[model samples]
Target: DMYQMISDDNPYETPMMIFPASHYTMGGIWVDYELQTSIKGLFAIGECNFSDHGANRLGASALMQGLADGYFVIPYTMQNYLSDQIKVPHFTTDAKEFDEAEKAVRARIEKLMNIKGTKSPDQIHKRLGHVMWDLVGMGRTLQGLVKALAEIEEVRKEFYTDLRVVGRADDLNTELEKALRLEDFLVIAKMMAIDALNRNESCGAHFREEYQLADGEAARNDKDYMYVSCWKYTGDNEKPVLLKEPLNYTEIKVQTRNYKS
Candidate 1:
């Protein structure tokens, strides 16, 4: 892109794109004590697995999680799981299960390629992004969240039915990649809105407009809703089941945060 002549020519000038990210809400995929996800061999480490940080994670803590997960944690934990699998025999891509999975993936790709719509994946994705930002990004309310869910559903429907993938699936197709990722992004956006709606009280990154005090602060209802709410993905356009893992504090007591000085 620099060579494409859109960026600042000067070396001392600011870069093309820079942004703050991953400070808060550093984790999402539910993992066990050993950082293993529901899929047996698939392990989520560092920020990928929901652990290590409080609701609002400071930037510095992500560094520790990264180091700990990469260096110390995943090695011992993954090895434990792998040790048992040593005698299970190595399976290649030619296996029956892998063949079926690959066929399903190729079928999805063909479906996207066959959509033959006018809008690019980027265009549809941008529209989806705008909907999320305006409706569900911040200053969220009951009505807004509900509307966001509706909009996201439309986006999801549009993605599957109207998305145009410009390149061949057999080749290295970046547009196809974007289309696939956009599908997942739509899922995340909907899940976020759904979870926001489920949790009645405002807490951390989820700042519901209805769940606020007169002085304009988050009113966290620990007595009723103090728990890690994990989601079970049902299907496209179906409501995700809310799986709540209640937080029972043993070492410390629950305390309200007073942000006002």
Candidate 2:
């Protein structure tokens, strides 16, 4: 009865919209054994880093992953890297690097403000949400993925030129922030689309419709795709390069999941 009260189709009486939305991503920024990112002096933990969870994480395990990384893993592993950075002095607000970064941000904000377009960022993002939901949400196919990529690119162009942001760069404007975030979302959307296209097999939550068996179960091509697909940012609107790290299974034999049995 309690379960039925919270489900989409409650046989017991109450019905609700309980379908899965974008909540967890087993795919994330790649990290090494030390939880260190590709960039030195940078580290990622928990859901942000693509570690521990693999491509498919079991339910209720994300909290454990976060706790382990925060309390146990990072404390020990980060010291190894941070110990070498003791000599580097603290940076000043007026430093050249800081100034350059600030300038870049200012330029971006100015561009957003000066767009002078009709559609608001939120409107464009809603359209983006629809695009992702239909093409890359759950059931994916090669043809759908290709179309999604093209549509996402169109969205990106429209976002830059047709965007409307009515706020000052120097002032506290939530709309401006939301607009900037939408820009990032578009970039990430494109990258995800490319990644999905490259991965021909269906493993974990990334189910490619074309890569399933006769029984509609996921068909994994472990021999060819038994490696991590890491994407590196090249430039704005440029294609990302995919690097692989082969997975070696010495202890356990990988097999299809059996939920019915």
Candidate 3:
């Protein structure tokens, strides 16, 4: 019920608090050892980048990655980058680029608010969440995936026409914030669903309904799908770039994962 409220296909009526559903990767910008993103003079450390986790992440490794990047990596890389720039030039808030970026942000918010739709933003968010939780949340199957894709399309249609935002563009509105986040979540949710559907065997968090052992445990087909699937988002209509990063095990021999006693 809680998950439904925050991630339902339709807008939620009662207010609810949503927990972090899965991995958090909002911290990485395009950074070097200095932990900087593509933007010059900007730095990102901790859980923000794609550097640490290679496909399926292990527990407690997040802490190590954060410490390594912040304490060890960034200091050295930042020093190298900063060595050449002795006197840094300061730019005012009214700079042309800054103004343009700010204007763009404001305009986007305005557009969302001005959308005279019948369905509320919460409605679309809930529908998307339901699809993700049911199809790509924990377990998956081909049939579920097909259903999820169809449901997502329906919800997306509602998002553009029925979805409503009840707040001013300039004000600090939590509802508007939620709407924007939902948009990103919807995109990511589909990616996860597709990734799970394409993977035939079960591995790590990806558990396919058709792929399981006789003892009722997840079965891995390492021979066929022992590589990490990396997806790059292209444009809206264009297909994503699919890349493979193979996993070779030397220290730990390949063995079936089991927890049954």
Residues 1-261, candidate 1: write the lDDT tens digits.
342375546435653343234335334577888889889999988766666764466566667888998999898899899888968987788889998998899888888899988889999999998887787765678999899989998888888777888978899999999998888898898888887788788887777888899998888998889888889899876778888888999999777766664
Query: Could you give candidate 3's per-residue lDDT for residues 82-129 as a string of tens digits?
Result: 887787787789889998998888887777777778777777887787
Sort the predicted structures by lDDT, highest score first: 2, 1, 3
Question: What residue runs in model 3 are displaced by over 4 Å at the alpha carbon?
Answer: 1-107, 250-252
Q: Compose the digit string of candidate 2's lDDT tens values, residues 70-96.
A: 999999999999888988898879879
> Please, what's the RMSD in Å of model 3?
9.4
How high is the CA lDDT of each candidate model?
0.80, 0.83, 0.72
RMSD, each candidate, Å? 6.5, 4.0, 9.4
Runs in model 1 lying further than 4 Å from the true structure = 1-27, 92-94
Clashing pairs in 1: none
Worst 10 residues of 2 by lDDT: 17-26
